[model samples]
Target: MKPLLALALLAALAAPADAQERSGIYQQGEFIDVWNHRGGHVLQMVQTREQLAATGRVVRIRGYCRSACTILTTLPNACLAPKARIGFHAPRIQGTQIIAPYVDQIMGSFYRGGVRERWFGGWNRSREMQVISAREYTRLDPQARFCPSLS
Candidate 1:
């Protein structure tokens, strides 16, 4: 009977996480160059942010999130991991260094807190990657907090 009880506990612990547990967390990962069609990228980010906002889940940023992924920092439920690093840069048209002001304007709309201020302050103008640690970002954006994990 004791062995059976131990086996049952082990089985329970091994069970797959439910949707509430899985979708509740978003792991911000590495790169994918959205070289062109930045307008489409902006649209998708807005839609994703809206859906995530409605879910009441937590978006945990980890590792290095670059380009379009940085836009998700706008999520109202966003949480920054201890080692989180985010990269930012101006949107450029396909195959050129020319900055896309209209696309960048849409991207800027997603930011709040000091992030928005910084965006307007010219972080968005960098042609090359501009990286910031989670702590620095949190300092600029008070809405985010340090959270490597929920517990």
Candidate 2:
């Protein structure tokens, strides 16, 4: 029983590592091109979000952007590679028409916390941006002007 339990625990610990996807960078000319080497494109958003939040730095990731990936792009620091396959379509309505509200909802989240927009849905802006630290995030709530997370 003890040996079996130890094996189970080890497997559990190793599971996430196995599940976690990673990107590979290849030297292409003067640039280091990054590609999803493991897992699916969906993991890109989750990992990038966590990494940016923890480090509070600019992040450049490449992958197909659509569906849930759109939601993940709400992170202020997100930048989609120009060649990435980015597609946005409305959710199916009844059988034929597409729902417009889905676009609004996705864009709304982008407005709420992600990018600051002088005009909505304008591609003229660069997606590359910076994330506010925990201190800056809380400055909105005058009660907590200082966040220990900033330290």
Candidate 3:
């Protein structure tokens, strides 16, 4: 679908801001928290994407979203804010520095094309978190378009 058409559809189907917020839906200004250090479980993130996909609601990444939260990028209905920053790092086994292949596999399954090849090229291999701004991320993955003006 055309970008504008998708945005228009979201606007039309979207519930009121307060209600949307309460229901864990994106409403431009608000964000879905996916912090890195919090290290949300990989399987849990898979479930998150499934749930959000079922809603057919637009998921916007505003402000900071890191780690497993970035998995939401796989959502077909996802969007990005101008100031968005997404962080990634090697998924480590809890309480250890060892990289978790299972976690990487799950995350890798969700991310493909440029997202898997370039963004995670070095980023996911390091324990150090790497962040890409909305501008950079858009260049890397054109599928993630910027959110439209609702007003």
Best by TM-score: 3
Whole-model lDDT values for every prediction: 0.62, 0.35, 0.65
Root mean square deviation (Cα) for candidate 3:
7.8
Residue-wise C-alpha lDDT for candidate 2, range 1-151, written one tens digit per residue: 3442343345444433432242332322222222332222334535544544444433333444443334333455443453333333333333445443444343434433322232134321223222233233223223222212212
Candidate 1 ranges beyond 4 A from true positions: 1-40, 148-151
Per-residue lDDT tens digits of candidate 1, residues 1-151?
Answer: 3442343345445534552222112222321111111222666667656755654656666556666677767676776667667778887776788888687788888777888888778878888878888889889888778764532
**Model 3 pairs whose backbones collide:** none
Candidate number with the higher lDDT (2 or 3): 3
Cα displacement (angstroms), candidate 2, residue 115, comes to: 11
In the range 57-91, model 3's lDDT, one tens digit per residue, is 56766666777888887688877777777888888
TM per candidate comes to 0.67, 0.31, 0.72
lDDT of 3: 0.65
Clashes of 2: 0
Best by lDDT: 3
Sort every candidate by lDDT, greatest first. Answer: 3, 1, 2
Question: With candidate 2 superimposed using the best TM-score fit, by how many Å does residue 53's alpha carbon deviate from the native?
Answer: 3.4
